[model samples]
Target: MKRIPKSLLKKLENRKEIGTFRTLKTKTALVDFSSNDYLGLARLDAISVRAKQILTDLGHSANGSTGSRLLTGHHPLFKKVEQQIATYHEAETALVFNSGYDANIGLFSALPQRNDLVFYDAFVHASIRDGLRLSRAKSYSFRHNDFEDLARKIEKLTSASSVWVVTEAVFSMDGDSPDWKSLAAICNRFEVHLIIDEAHATGVLTQLTEIYKQTTIENHLTARVVTFGKALGCHGAAVLGNASLRDYLINFAGSFIYTTALPPAALATIAAAYEKLQDKIGLESLHQNIDIFNRSVVNLDLKQHFILSQSAVHCCIAPGNEHVKMLSMQFEKSGFDVRPILSPTVAARKERLRFCLHAFNTENEIESALKLLATLL
Candidate 1:
């Protein structure tokens, strides 16, 4: 084989220098705190059973989508899941994508026209950033959750081009939320379109949706992206918006157009998960666990150490990448699955230990984790 490229070697060296080189590891069987399966639906026996039945009922036993949705892979289950999502989220229409990444990339890359200007929160997800990277539109980052800075930037750009304000309902690393009410007002005053990425918020939809409902602005701003893999504890994602926006993405979003659709079994599980959550068993338990986790954080006096988050995701900032990784190993050793958010993924000083709470996490686990955190932090 030819010698490894010098440029690639240099890139690896730079990653090592910053302590941000990446590797993959099989999941350790530990108490849950790392995975995005907030409601524990990922491994729920009921979901699996329902998925099996859905596959049986469909009379199709395929193992894959086999082709892009635009070609031979538009499964009937796709329509079923998309319809359920639209109804559940109260959107005029819904278009499902392979994953949250695909949904964000497809929407961001295609929706903004050449003359448009995109104003995104500085801390939006990496996929959103990647999508923005591929777009022809001029894009600028406003200070994270700083509505005033966002307003000023919007004012500067609105006259020259159509504007889109993009933000996540809950930031992944920081476990914080944008000032959506103020953001909506600013977007309305400037006649700018507003888009929200609800990947983190999907776990606590009632709370987040209430915020949206209370916003002073009445006009349809733009769109909202919700993913199932996080809170829904399943797979896939959906873009929620007016019928026209959905149509536009179908026509223009290359990520959606060119990618193979999710398997029918996956779609069935999504529907089953939502159906289950709507009833009291799973949803109520998840809410109760969130409450328990919050109280534990407070009781342990670890509140000062953690980012204030009402959602299932919580974080304790541990400045350097090395420090955070070491702390995560300690967590793992103690039988927890917490993960470190390293620099380059986040900014240098903003590294953190992310604890993803799940409904199935016992009170003992929550208390034990917090007690450990109190000692560690």
Candidate 2:
């Protein structure tokens, strides 16, 4: 390796001073609460088997994609999977990308033109922010989940250029969601294009059973991004939109154009995962766990410590980096896999312990975990 750079050393020193230094650790075999395998599909051998079987049935056994999809890697399976995803999400078309990061980078960096305006939530994923940083458009952040703030920002822009807006269906860190219907209505009234990253909602919110239980926001979006890595427990993501938008991405998105395509196994696994999403066992059990978790938090009087959310992700605010890390260590020592969300990743005062509920987690596990939390408080 080359000689260490002093500037890089100083940056690491600063991170340590602020208690924001990050390091990798291997996975541990504890009662789960940290991993994003919300439906526990990552542990399912059948899904892998099904993926292989599908590849065999489709006459594909390539261990690697030979090149970028635009070159030699545009397998026939891509068309089928994209169409299947489009229909499932009720979108007119869908285009697959290597990952959620790639999809977001491709969309934001390529879609927003020089004269256009791009507005995003302050707490949107880092990938989106990085994409916006690369964009030529004028961009601004609205207060998190505050539609009024978004409205005020939109009203201040006095340009004739097109406006593009983006937010997450289920925010990754906070586990809270924007009022999709209201946001969509606002975008529709303003005639601005809207995009949603459904990374955390792909399997969990499939049918949209809530106040408007029978309706989904599928038609409300100009484009939607879905990743199979979270609840779906696979790898890869897709951009959902009209055929023209798909064509535009294919043409201009350098991230999509230059990168080698996802191999047949990954594509097959995503397809199998989507098929598994339709099954009642994993997804239904996951929801039931969420419900059980909600009741447990209330019964244990730990609700106030937690951010109100109905999603698989629930956050309990810990206020300081040291304190939250200590708490997370306690949970790990007690056989729970809960992890701390440190500052710099979140607001400094809003560091939290993120509990990810899953289908494989027993009701007893949920009850015990919250009970342990109550005692700590």
Candidate 3:
């Protein structure tokens, strides 16, 4: 009964005043345009059925992972799935974590010891930043996707005992990518290790995000983090690297060491998703939708308002939080499911409507949404 803490109340008041207060809501019947299910696998009943089949065939019927992997939860399926992940992604070994957040937190917190220097992109995912915050290493942020800025920072401290470079393959909010080859070359020149989160580019398992599409970036880079929540339409994330790195995480990464392991269904779902990735059924349809959406944006003359991106995420700057939320309401009324990314999630002026493209989205749907958006603008 202590008046609910004045400081906490003040922060809540400030959020409401700025239109940044958040609330949970149930799913809607509006057209799909805001989910991370880029490949539409989440809607495929076959995947769910297959997941169950994989689990049963493996002779496991447990609903929970019993305990932490290092203790009692390290199931036999973990080894099998990890091997498949390594072969599919061409990594020497792979370590699966409960989620992307856990993977990054464990990797960053454990790998970079005290006195090491860490440089991350300005727009890198929050998970990586949080991990660095929990580490003892000295860290700096370079300009977003700017190799020159990163180079300057590296030059200032090239003599550090160890240096790590962190970035994302496809930025979650902006939907743009950095030049991996360029970043790799710079890291190599400065004797630094490179880490990339491929959360937004999962599913297809292509080299599309890399400048050299024909070859794998695993050897040119140090580590890669891939997740299933986005394009793969599943759960769980894995850090792909060499065998020694996996050993290191198993031995030292606290997040990996002290956490309860993912259940068998999650691992089975992961295996099923990768199988679908290999068959390439959903990839083509998803890529087609992305192409259609990209073309429709240009054709509708909404290019000026949109962020330049080749990924499934498209952002249209709407300036004010109030204005953006109003625009989102308009979109919902028009049968589109676009959502407003208000301040504090992104910077204040960067508030905008985010449209998430999916393979299930039709060309007409894409064009119609853009046409309506054009008229509103």
Candidate 4:
């Protein structure tokens, strides 16, 4: 076998020196504060039962989707689940992808032409940035969640046949959201096509309602990338838009064209998870935990150390990578699963302890975790 090149080894050495060396760890029984199962649907027995029922009903006994969707892998469940997702999200159609990364890569790389311009939020997920890099369109990023800066940048664009703007509904790391209304107004005024990644916000923001119905900007959005892996605790993603956009992606997106489809069981699980989103108890409990977390931060006077967010993800800044990693270890010792966000995942001196709250996390757990964090700080 060939050994790794010296340049790659040097990069690994740099990561170690900077305290950002990466390693995979097995899941522990520590009190959950790290996983993306925000609604706790991944462990829900009812979802498993329904998913099994779905597979049985479809007579899908296959272990894998033997080919890509364009070939033999386009299972019957795909149409059923895609329609369900479209209806739930209030879109004309939905195109399922293997994952959120696939959806972003497909949409951004295939949709935007050479004469187009894309302006994205500075802090969007790396997937979006990578997609933009593959696109023929010119792309630039504005300050994080700053619509005014976005407008200024757009105004400075000399010549572009079309304009597109991108942002996330709930930023994964910061757990904060942009001003949707303001962003919509800008897009509307400028006739800019808008794309929003709703990976973290999918089930959390609108458990009982469609996301389109919750905001006035629904009609203004050109596309919405939603993932089932986060709050839904499923294993796929979808791009929701008009029928034409879905058709275009099917015909042109390389990622979707080349990759094998998700297995029948994964699709069934995603469908079951969508149905589980209608349960008010989980949504209510998750929101309540978020509220408890906020209040505890305020009571402990730790609000200043954390980012202001209404989402299930709350980040408490701890600066240097070494410092933040140490704090995470402290939390682990206290039987919590909080993790550190290191650079260049984030900027230098902007590393943090990322706390992901979940529906199953009790008020006692919330309070205790915050108290421990406060003491450690």
Candidate 5:
């Protein structure tokens, strides 16, 4: 075997200094304040049973996508789900990808040409950064959610090249959202292509259709990317755009072309999940839970400790890596599956405990968790 290099070891050492090392774990039997299953679809027996029925009905008993989507892997479920998603989100078309990461990589690496310029929020997700890194376009970051700074940067870039403006609908860590209408207006004024990654927003927002209708600054927008892994509690993602963008991606987007299609079961699950979203009563219950969680935070006086948010995800700042980890352990001991967002994942000094709110979380559990948090902080 070839010897392991010491330089790679040094990189690991650097991560430790900043208190940002990654680890995996087994499932914990706790009241979840840290899962992305906001609507409880991931755990629903009905969804699973329906997915199985879908598979049996379609006679797609295969365990794998036999080839890339361009070849034999493009199943009928893909078309059905794509059209359903497009109609749900009120877009001209929708293209499904294997996952959120793949969708972001495919879009960023392929859409931006060498002469194009990309401007993104400084605090956008790592997947966006990775995608940008793979592109030939000149890219720069604006201050996080600072539209004025973004406008200035865009103005400068637009004079030299076509501009692509990007940001998340809701920031994953900060638990806040960019002003979509205002930002989209700015993109319109500059005649730039606007793109939003709705990975964290799709199932959480009641006004998603209104937001989508308003998110477009003009006709220049290439697309919006929405993922199911987070709020939808399923496993795949879709890029929503016009017919041309879909066709172009089919031909380009190396990540889309080079990877195997998602399993037929997964696609069926995604479809059924969307169908369930039409149940107004359930979505309302999820919103009520979010309200209850926020109220609990206020009652415990932990509001000041938390980042302001209306989404299912809430965050409480703990400052240092050691501090966040310690607090997270306390929650774990008390039977909550809260996660610690360490530095490098976020920035230094911004380490936090992230609580992912879910519809099924009882009022008692929500209050107890906040009470525990108050004691810890």
Candidate 6:
């Protein structure tokens, strides 16, 4: 077997020294407070049944997408699902990608050209940052969720061929959201294109369609990246924009063009998930759990430790990697599945316990977890 380079070994050693080394663990039977299945659709048997039915209806029994979408892999379900997603999201068009990461990479890398300027929130997802790294555009980061800072930075940029602003509807780590109205207003005032990653917001933010319908937000909003993996409890993602953006991506987005298309079954599952969204029972239950969790945090006097959020994701800061990891272990021992967000993933003192609320999480479970967390703290 070949040995890894000393540089790589040193990096691993550094992670261990800082108590930030990571390892994968199999799913356990602990009470759920960690997975991204916000609407509980991932484990909903009905979705599976519906997805199978969809595949049968479409006569798509193939096990794989043999080629990229532009090649032989553009299956019939792609068009149907894309149209469904666009209609659901109130977008002019929607173009599907293999995953959220691919969607972001494709959009950011392909849209911004040389002399184009991109101003993104400082704490936007790593995928977006990676995409920006591939772009020829000059990029700058504004303070997270700070519209004033974003405006100030844009004002400093006196000249550019084109300007773009990027942010997320809901930040994954902090579980906080940007003020969409304020952010959109800033983009409109500057006459810049606006892009929002709705990976953590899809299905979870029930008001999204109505929010997009507002004329003020609709005008300068260039694109939105929505994922099926989180709230939808499925795979794949889509870029929502006008037909021209879809056409441009189909032609120039390397991530979308080069990657093999998603399998027929995955598309079927996504369609099934979208169908489930219309029922509203799961969504209602999920929001109720979120409310319960929020109330529990306050009741247990743990609100100060938590980030303010109305989303399914809620993070409680525990500082050091060792400290946060210890708290996570304690929660696991108590039969809850809360996980720690370590440094490097976040900043050193901002390490936290990420609690993901779901529709299936019972009221008792929510209260008990917070009470345990409070005692542990």
Model 1: which ten-residue window has the lowest total lDDT?
Answer: 212-221
TM-score of each: 0.94, 0.96, 0.95, 0.97, 0.95, 0.98
Stretches of candidate 5 exceeding 4 Å from the true structure: 1-3, 13-18, 214-220
Winner by TM-score = 6
Error of 6 at 79 (Å): 0.7
Off by over 4 Å in 6: none
All candidates' lDDT scores?
Answer: 0.83, 0.87, 0.86, 0.90, 0.85, 0.92
In terms of lDDT, which candidate is stronger, 2 or 6?
6
Write one digit per residue (lDDT tens) for candidate 5, span 1-377: 98679998888888777667666798889888888888888888788888888889987657887889999899888988899999988889999998899999999988888999999999898888999999999899999999999988877655546788899888888878987777877877888887888898877775866765667653656788999998778899999999999999899998899999998888989988887776642567778888998898888788888888988889999999999999999999989999999887888888899988888888898888889989888
- Model 4 alpha-carbon drift over 4 Å, by segment: 207-215
- Candidate 3 lDDT over 295-314, as tens digits, reads 88888888899888878888
What lDDT tens digits, residue by residue, belong to model 4 across residues 1-377?
Answer: 99899999999999888677899999999999999999999889999999999999877569998999999999899999999999887779999999999999999999889999999999999999989999999999999999999989999995999899999989999999888668777877788888999999998988312444555577668899999989998788999999889999999999899999998999999989988875553898899889999999999999999999899999999999889999999999989999999988988889999999999999898899999988889
Superposed on all Cα atoms, the candidates' RMSDs to the truth, in angstroms, are 1.8, 1.8, 1.9, 1.4, 1.7, 1.1
Question: Alpha carbon lDDT of residue 371, candidate 4?
Answer: 91
Tens digit of per-residue lDDT, candidate 6, span 134-160: 999999999989999988999999699
Backbone clash tally (model 4): 0
Worst 10 residues of 5 by lDDT: 212-221
| Residue 147 lDDT, candidate 1, scale 0-100 | 87
Candidate 5: count of backbone clashes, pairs at least 3 residues apart or interchain? 0
TM accuracy, model 6: 0.98
